[model samples]
Target: MTKMNHKILLGAAITLASLQQASAVPFAPSDARSMGMGGTGVSSAEVASTVQFNPALLATTREDDHFGLKIPQFSLSVADDGGFIDEAEDFDEESELDTTGQGRTNVDLLSDLLDEATGPLGLEKMQQGIEELKAAQLLPNSAPIAKKTAYDNAATKLTQASEFLDTRLYSRNPSVNGEAGLVVYSGAIADDMDDLNNKALRINGGLNVAGAVPSKKFSMAVHAGAQVTFSGKVKIDPKDTDILRNYSAATSAYLLNIDALQLALTNLDENDSSTFDAVDTAQQAVDNFNYGGAGRPESEGNTAIFVDGELSPEAEDADLDSEIQMIGVAVADVGVTASRVFNIKGHDIAFGITPKLQKISIFDYTQELDSEEEFDSEDFSENQEDYSAFNIDLGAAYQFGAEKQWQAGLVIKNLIGDDYESAEYISSNGVGGAVVSISPMMRAGISHRTSWTKVAFDLDITENDPVAFEDPTQYAAIGGELNVWRIVQLRAGYRANLAGSDQDIMTAGIGISPGPVHLDIGVMANTSDIENEAGIALEFGVEF
Candidate 1:
């Protein structure tokens, strides 16, 4: 157990501990009422919830007048399976170490240490060398000549170290010596590293407003809503870039320009260059850490650049912004819906249609981050593409049971089955472009009701393909709600993904209708092995 390796491990552990929270793809209801009943309302919605769940149900409402406004909502759903927090939790502190207690470390440890000048490897290596030289001066019984040589060499090393400490490479351009510098000892993302690195993030939010005119035979409503979905990963990839290349050369120049290290690196062996040597280039070298004459290759007059003075692979690469990929989509919908109730064969049936206009915007982006800061939002939107289109939604509900308390509802959304192309960007080098497909989904549901309690079930007949790399979803759910004198209601339900990728989602909600002002809140928990998750929702609206 050498004291040195222990310090290295401690430093590495601390560096690896810096992690950003992760976001993953999640499913949440658009409105609070549906959120409460297992994200269900296809056949069981009344009040203003009818606009979103099933427009046909608007004609069957028991309330005299209808209007709704939900100002804001926040839903934090957990999906840590591929998130940064999960990997940080499972990091193996001793995985890179050998059991023999040898003084060896992964040479690539320099990459992380290089990211910070004060890191263990660089500072410790320098200090260790100084200490070893000092110890040599204390040898006993040595020749006076040998002792004098040891003392002289040690004094010279200390002097040069002091000079380098005062150099501009360290004083002014601290970033390269800071977080921007890293020479990857490991190759591209490997399997072991992939496991340690994989993690994503997803955030979603929405707002809505609606009002309805109700009658026994016919009803009409106008619903407007806007939603946004943001998804990205917390992992950074190593790539070559023009910016880093210059930085690498600059760092190399400074390390080489230091008199102490230059004495060794620039010294010529028997076969030295015809003319150039440390003494020749020493005066011309700037303390910028880039001694290679504007970072040109060695053949281009950077003969003074070798050993410690040349550019590192980490410094030569560019575009720290290209490390992470993010995708965002915003959709605003305005729909005018109308429904009519019919009596056919002693049955009460209603049919509704909604013609809506949608403005779609998508930002498909990839950036190489130079530092840990965020991407510029204004710059991101500037490169986005948006479009507007019209669509139709058709719905039908039939009442049939011993007491007509049972209802069956069917909804066909985006009946046109349209395709949308989100914003697409390709670099001049043809290396970066992400094309995503925006598609459609259709669903249906049924529910039975009584004076105080109602039970419902819903299913998505079509697979809802995700735009990003997320999984497609096709699920079925069963839920129920109990009303106490139409004052406060308790609701619970469960849903399963028929697509085979999700868990049995358990849901519960509480609603307080207190007359015209209505408030409903719901929660959903993923109980199966599919990435551990839980979600919450809230909505408050007024109806006449």
Candidate 2:
């Protein structure tokens, strides 16, 4: 093997090792034959993977199917900065966290204060503020939550505030230019965490061993495999909007007063006679929003209630959807299958089934993002859950035509429908627990084949009910392949979601089979001004 190839294989081994700790197995394991056909193996199966897609195809009886073995296979599908892979590979971005640490901020003067306000150290300050309020008989009416000490109460509230940010991520990092800057411009850890959540890149891959044995009209195949997948997304939970609005309002007013105080004393605006007037206005604004019960402005002519002035944020945005979301799924499956075919009238029809066992692991992690601790891999399992089940897949395929080259196939996976509980993902937001429904997955396809060419169409007839925090999808796909005397193959196809997803994916693949040894590769991509996504697959095996 070439040095580069050797290194790539070594890296894959290392990754599989790390992923194993998390109990993540590959989600889907596809071979070159099906990859070359745009993921259509139902009625288009030309190889042993019939064990996975349509066991029925395994019963078609192949002249050279006595034994088949796939030593190893790997696939990659990534979007959003290549799921951090590209970033890790690039040397220039290695120091990005350092460069942006605490230096690059709009409010350079308040950077230190910002850190204190939004970090572990700041909990002490918040506690002190509460104690001072109690000393002055200005304690919050909602104080003493859970009968804790002053510092504990303050810390608890602060924690809730952080969770508010965690559950309802802000849309895009707020700029320090207007009302939007209340949370982010301060260099708050909460804001930084939201930014991290938004950059959720997705990565998935796998490893496996599979093959088949054929005997005239009765054939069967058995296989085993594992996969690991990770994905991230960011959203704001509307349920927590009101609580966050209060914090944001009070915080913005306080910070604004400080800025206005500085501006009131500025020489740049000194030429203006209303500098002191602006200062008084800022002071009044701060007091009005201080959450100090039944208070009035210190200014002689100012009042807390203004008939018309800037107002606090509404209870929620027009869209109540949360602002940030992320999910990681690790699942493994092992199965044994069998199939049989019968000739009736002028058509050959086949039936197949596979019973399997699956184990799924879940992680529901929430952390003080933007902290040094967040960078440590050891902390990844702060929130995790696991589940296991047994299932079965059933498939049927029919071929009718003078030459029996026309075919139709159907398959149902997870036929019994297994429900795996997700980690309890709760904050101020409403219940969005991690429960996943391992519902039935149904697929169908039709195809026509000749000695040198094949054409096919496939589609998802029912949605693969969500097992994570993601949208449901249904797809329509069409593909074609050209073969050169079973020695070389060229393939291409297009697949799109019909369930209102912005998906327009294109696929292509090539395969070379020199007798018993075969090699194949496939590519898939969908890019737009807003998103760029792509995937590739490679498999090697021998057929006899």
Candidate 3:
């Protein structure tokens, strides 16, 4: 049970847990079409899947189908590099222990101990040693005394070392690491490190919008939908007693071979390891000295009764729970549009433009430690309310040739430069630090229809831009979709952050229609990791 073995086990466990949680979704429109390019209807009545992608596209829906739903499985992965130092330390410690064992006088005993420990070498060396010992008849089946003795002694020491190393490597860092700014660290450090490194999930839901729109040429739709996001959080309290800061410090020092402290801790006999004990006791004392009035007595009728019956001013406990709140509408979108057809050289060309308004409300709660009171604030207040923003979408389709067999269209989305502003309380007023996004999108698709099947190909691209709170530059998505039989769709594409980080996505979806009801299911996968996503959408409409 060397540190190396413990770390290897921990790493495997983290990797497996992450794989089990991987899930995916289309972060862009092309992703949706990869499942199936079926949104080209003639009226809003048949445009029921997640309507947010393109409000104007609703006009393409068939007139008879009136309602729709889209439930997509969602997941994500996020990773950070700060915590790997501890894992590396575990590796280094194990290596040192192995070297130390080689220097021992009794190599056989060392080998026996290694065999009992759950590690790479333990299993391999143990098997080899056992075979050799058996071949030499050093201990026959009837004379197991020497063999048993060797096995037990080795097993005991290995077990102890393994247990100690496991506790040290996987446990949370009791003392905060790095500078105390922005990101906070807590929770099971090993697992939390893995969690923060990556995130993936699946969300499913659908949209129901009826009586919200009028016709294909000019209409509006209001959709109601629900989304469940799957993710993980690391909850850590710096006050946990199990966290040994000096142990963390020792491990850190061990990593650097700074032996002053280690030599001091080792010189004392096992019974006099009071230095470590004193360190733990001092930490507990500091943790219990709550300056935040958490455990202080409160005034009853303006009178305070002290523990010793001495009168003192009563202090109220901080309200930890009331600092958070939730309030907001589920879903809403408004739009106005106009469209017309014109004859150009006897060819029919249809074009349209849509103006849209979008509004969002978000609630947040956070506690700031009040050093004077040794507690946190309990007050909760309105955190974010973003004002509406106006965006325009334009599209045009041209029919070609005598039979009008060839058709192509272009769509430009989010044409306006409206920097949606965050609520005053949560504003990021820095240069180029705006809340709204102006994504200029371009999409083109061609479809061929025969008696038995319908096939289509689509390509979509949106330029990248960075958000205020995130990295300075991140790109929108670019992807393609393939559809067949009007029922099956396949998608694939590559997305890259403006910073140059990239990942690939793939997806498949199926559509089933029965009279006025329609059901769509889609699954997505990512190439960079084991992330995947699945979604189901339903719509009810009539063909006019």
* Per-model TM against the reference: 0.64, 0.63, 0.45
Ten residues in sequence with the least summed lDDT for candidate 2: 1-10
Residue 497 accuracy (lDDT) in model 1: 76
lDDT of 1 by residue, 450-530 (tens): 889999999887776543433456778888999998889999988877765645678889989898777888887777643
Give the count of colliding residue pairs in each prediction. 24, 19, 56
- Judge candidate 1 at residue 151 and give its lDDT: 39
Report, for every candidate in turn, its global Cα lDDT versus the true structure: 0.56, 0.54, 0.34
Q: Which regions in candidate 2 have their CA more than 4 angstroms from the true location?
A: 1-28, 80-201, 236-326, 344-346, 370-372, 375-382, 423-432, 527-531
TM-score of 3: 0.45
> Higher-lDDT candidate among 1 and 3?
1
Model 3 over residues 449-519: C-alpha lDDT tens digits?
33343444444544343221122223333333443544443434343344434333344445554443344
TM-score of 2: 0.63
Q: What is the TM-score ranking, best to worst?
A: 1, 2, 3
Task: State candidate 1's TM-score.
Answer: 0.64
Relative to the unseen true structure, what is the C-alpha lDDT of residue 272 in candidate 2, on a scale of 0 to 100?
43
